[model samples]
Target: MTAPVDIERARFNMIEQQIRPWDVLDLDVLGLLNEVKREEFVPPAHKALAFVDMEIPLLPDTDEALKNGHCMLPPKVEARLLQDLAPKAHEKVLEVGAGSGYMAALLASRAQRVITLELHPELARMARENLQQAGIRNVEVREADGSKGLAAEGPFDAILLSGSVHEVPQALLQQLKVGGRLAAIVGDLPVMRATFVTRTGEAGWETRQPWDIAAPRLAGFPEASRFHF
Candidate 1:
């Protein structure tokens, strides 16, 4: 078992080395990264990988054949997404794919309130437990398919897809307030871009692809149709 001091050192190194190098320079975001104990959110079986620069599986045994495996995004990816989205203290945020609720915890620290949706019931329960243990009170973890976004409680200031999607569904964009921003990773395997969609007007939106990174697809999202012509 690693000592507490060692775990703290690893978390510091993760922020200074892995996350900072990826352009996540927001001081508040960095501070929140340190405030939240990532190891607690990580599965006990993989606790050693809490600060490692790779995705950490949330489940003890994830089926390889599963279409949407439950896992936490790499520390850098999560940090970068947070920095890019820039959730404000008074803003309401919506997060899709609450694996361990670590990301939701981060968002809740910055936003007024956060509503995260998870497809797996066990994962959803785990997320709620983790957030509660972490003393995060502004985030809610709901077990549901989040591909379509939560409309009834939406019109949020910011939205984030914690996992990759083949395409950002129009329904999600519509849930964003007129000036809200949404961040998502869009594309197929081998190549994917981190995209930001900002609602400019009642029906106008602008998109920008800032970087490339791949993540497991969020379950229940639509897959692009293949053409064999």
Candidate 2:
């Protein structure tokens, strides 16, 4: 068993080696990566690998990965994407995956309000508890499909997905307030680029490739609904 002290040092090393070279330049983000105790959110059985470069399984291993909802993104990729979002104080944010509520907790430190949607009910509950334990009140963890996105309480200032998608969901794009940004890894396995799409104006969305990454595709997202399919 890796001692908590060792695990923390490894996390710092992971940030210096994997994230800094990836061009994540924000000092606050780099500091948060080291400050947040990721192992606290990971299942006890797998806590030892929290700082390792491999994905940590959050759900039971299943024949179909999409159905299992088990994969937690590597620490470096998670930190870099969070840095890209650059959440502002008091901004209403929407996050598509709650994973372990770790990402939402990070966003909570920077944003005013965060509504994080998680497809798995267990994960959602776990996220809620973790957020409370961490004393972060700015985030709301709910059980919902990321693809369907959040309805009713939207028009978000910034939206982020903790998983990948083959393409951006139009409904999600519609949910973003003008000038709001959305980030997700969009592409096939073994190779995918983290993409950031910003709503330039009411009718314009400009896409930019922020970084190269590999993340599991979010479950429940439909195939592009015909036009963009």
Candidate 3:
């Protein structure tokens, strides 16, 4: 018989090898990685792959999962994003693409509150259930199109797009409070950049590209028009 997987050691290796080297050196962020049981947030069928350096599908193995864009971000990507955003205890965060609610859980642990939106009905339900099961109360999971941003809950302190987009939507940018920051992976496949935008004024914004990272395309956003000529 095969020996059981060493859960704690795997978690350690994941942090030291995959996350730390990626410049996710924030002590608070690293500590949160240990405090939260990533294995529990993962789907049972994928529990063994939780700490691996790949995206874990939120749903069980199925073609529908691919079509629905339902998969958690890779460990290093998630950790790095969290460190960049650095949500504060007094801030309210908006997270687009609530894949399995793991990212929301991480944001909620730092921010005062987190509102995560998922487009797929089933995925939204799963996120809610997973967050509840993990006893994460500061997060509110909504079943809605995240591409447009939640105007009703406008003026968030920080916003995060959990997947890749050809460009950041203006609607989402308009939802940020002045002085607030928004992070997203922008540009098409094979060349996506981790773009960060800060709302500097009522109608002003400053943008920065700190690094490059590829992620699955998030559904619901409008695709850019292409020229045939």
Candidate 4:
């Protein structure tokens, strides 16, 4: 029989080897990485893979939509994104994907409130149950298409797209309060970059692409058209 995995050791290695090296140096973000048990949010079959450096599938292998698999972003990516947005204690954050609520749980530890939207119903239910079980009260998971963002609950202090997209939607940008920051992975495969946008004024915005990273495409967002030659 296989020996039980050393959970804490693996968690430490994940932080030291993967996360910290990636420049996720914020104390609060790093500390939350320890406080929130990633394994708890992972599916049962994938519990051991929680601390691994790859995306963990949230759905069953036999599920058709999961042919490529709907998954939680890798730990380092999640930590880095969380660090970039830097949600404050009084700020309200909007997370566009609620895979299993792990990211929302992280956001909730720092932000006053977090509204996470999940397009998949099963994933939404999973997120809600996980958050409830974790005793996290500040996160609300909405089962709706997040590609357009939550406008009715607008003017968030920070917004994070937990998945990659072709481009950051203007609707989502318009929802940010002035001075609010939004982080997302934009562009297509093999060349995607992490894009950060800050709302500068009522009709002004600034963008920065700090690093390159590619992730599975998030569904439901409008696709950019291309004409075949």
TM-score of each: 0.96, 0.90, 0.95, 0.95
lDDT of 2 by residue, 31-139 (tens): 8876677778887767778778877877656335434545678887887888887789969999998988888988888899999999888889888988888788889
Please, what is the whole-model Cα lDDT of each candidate in the order they appear? 0.92, 0.82, 0.90, 0.90
Pairs clashing in candidate 4?
Answer: none
List, residue by residue over 1-229, the lDDT tens digit for candidate 1: 5458988999999999999999999899999998888998998988999999987878766564134558999999999999999999999999999999999999999999999999999899999999999889999999999998899998999999998999999999999999999999999999999999999999999999999999888999999999777
lDDT, candidate 4, residue 81? 92
Q: Which stretches in model 1 have alpha-carbon errors above 4 Å?
A: 1-3, 63-67
Report backbone clashes per prediction.
Answer: 0, 0, 0, 0
Residue range 111-198, candidate 4, lDDT tens digits: 9999999988999999999999989999999988888898999999999998888988899999999999999999987799999999
lDDT of prediction 2? 0.82
RMSD of each: 1.9, 3.1, 2.6, 2.7
Candidate 4: RMSD to truth: 2.7
Give the Å error, residue 127, model 4.
Answer: 0.4
In model 4, which runs have C-alpha deviations exceeding 4 angstroms? 1-5, 62-69
Best by TM-score: 1
**Sliding window of 10 residues with minimal summed lDDT for model 4:** 61-70
Q: What tens digits encode model 3's per-residue C-alpha lDDT throughout 107-179?
A: 9999999999999888899889989998999999999999999999989999999988889999999999999
Which has the better lDDT: candidate 2, or candidate 4? Answer: 4
